[model samples]
Target: MCVVLAALLAFELFQPAHAQIPNAAQGYQRELTRVVQQEWGMNGRVAVHAAQIHQESAWRSNVNSPVGAQGLSQFMPSTSAWIAEIYPDLGRAAPYSPGWAMRAQARYNKWHWQQLASAADECQRWAFALSAYNGGLGWVNRDRRLATAAGDNPRVWFGSVEKYTHRAGWALRENRHYVRHILLTLTPRYERAGWQGGAPCNA
Candidate 1:
């Protein structure tokens, strides 16, 4: 936690600033939790995923990113198109349907996890996998190899491997900050709910 806090306070690179959670999501919480738990596991990720959707798209069903990412998940066109192909029903109504968008986000988050295997516990898994969600899986793997080559623990995210992320071609401050922000802000909520990955988070 101290490491991430230092990174947040000392970062000199360009990462997009994010706003805090809205006071009222108007049922967004319950619905999002339901959708995420259904598609992902009943694990504590429901809150994390919901927080991500809040940060990513602010729960806007019709939101579009300047980079062509769209929907509640801020998924890129190519990614969403692929998501739609696999989740035909959910993708059919994406970007315009809040429910569908959340569903798609859940599925996509799962896909992100599958992109890499981890011997790390659930908490560390989120640190690595969420970085992949924001950066790219290939970049994360590349950084892992870089960390190993540099005599760092490839699986240690915050204090070790994350340092190598900035060296990867596509790894940027935004991706590093994304995982930190998510865990920092939402871990308590997940821990209170008895989620697997919520412990040891001082943030």
Candidate 2:
């Protein structure tokens, strides 16, 4: 009984840390995680940003947002071209190539997060990076400034932003659904990997 309890406790502790992120996520999410892990040396919960990508593009390689963001991770054409230019390894083909796009996203995500302290954990940086990825860091910054001016909580994710406050459009709805999907998908994987966060496989 003691041995069984110890085994259960060990599994519980190691579960989230060893949680297997999908190697391929039907389309964009898979390609994106490959890049993130390959280029960024990020895996496990540290690479949770893949969840954000899954939510955003649902693995579409050639999708363009109504706002004109393009490709798997939905980069703005200018952003895509600019990244390609800087990392010429990410050439014209890079934007269209899922593999290249993943590396590019990893590079971009790394660069963006490097602006913050290295001591920060993945959860701390991932959420901020997701905000930047989704809403544009400039937009997020502008919102923060406005919130600061208004004496609101400028640092947290409370619904202080005008769009969030107003429940703007399908972005919020779609994002929520996507995040939920990632969470649900992860729960099962976590269980299979011996995580206590999920129902028993035998049951």
Candidate 3:
């Protein structure tokens, strides 16, 4: 009995593989939390990214950009197709299916994040990856190099790269909203976890 109980406990700790895919707005928050946690090394970072996604699309699974982006993560159709290639069955399936789109986007995000492994163990890595996820990695890389050369503080996002890309202005504004939403919603839990971004407002 004890062994069976232990196995159940272990199973309970992991979310279902499908937990990262959500169809309803109500479920997106939970699924986003799971995805962020899966992709990000830290819980706090996951919370932050989840908030960002909320800010960007309000958890809309079929959101389409005026320019051609599609799906929950607002991936360009080509990018979505590329991500779909990673899953053979999915490549044959509809790219706009909520579950397929979510999986593809998550895989793409994970790939993008991995490209910055040099920034491992640093919050800036998360920040930079988020920037690249919104903008493009090529632009973010240019900014990173310039910022590094100028002796700028590269640890925190300061909108320094906005000048480099026209898309960045909107991306920066959206990311700021993302940070705010996450901070507001998760502040209580983060504080309880000893969050240092600020003193607990309630305590």
Q: By TM-score, how accurate is candidate 3?
A: 0.60
Question: What's each prediction's clash count?
Answer: 0, 2, 0
Worst 10 residues of 2 by lDDT: 194-203
Task: Report lDDT (CA) for all predictions.
Answer: 0.67, 0.52, 0.52
**Candidate 1 to truth, TM:** 0.78
Report the lDDT tens digits of candidate 1 across residue range 137-162. Answer: 88889889999999988877877788
lDDT of 2 at 65: 80
Q: Pick the candidate with the highest TM-score.
A: 1
RMSD of each: 5.5, 8.9, 12.0
Give one digit per residue, the lDDT tens place, for model 2 in 28-137.
44444455566656533322445445555655667778888776667887887777777787667355566766677777776666653331343334444555566556
lDDT, residue 69, model 3:
72
Q: Where does the lowest 10-residue lDDT sum fall in candidate 3?
A: 194-203
Q: What tens digits encode model 3's per-residue C-alpha lDDT throughout 126-188?
A: 556666776678867776666566765444343333323334467657654443333334333
TM-score of candidate 2 to 2 decimals: 0.58
* Candidate 1, position 58, lDDT: 69
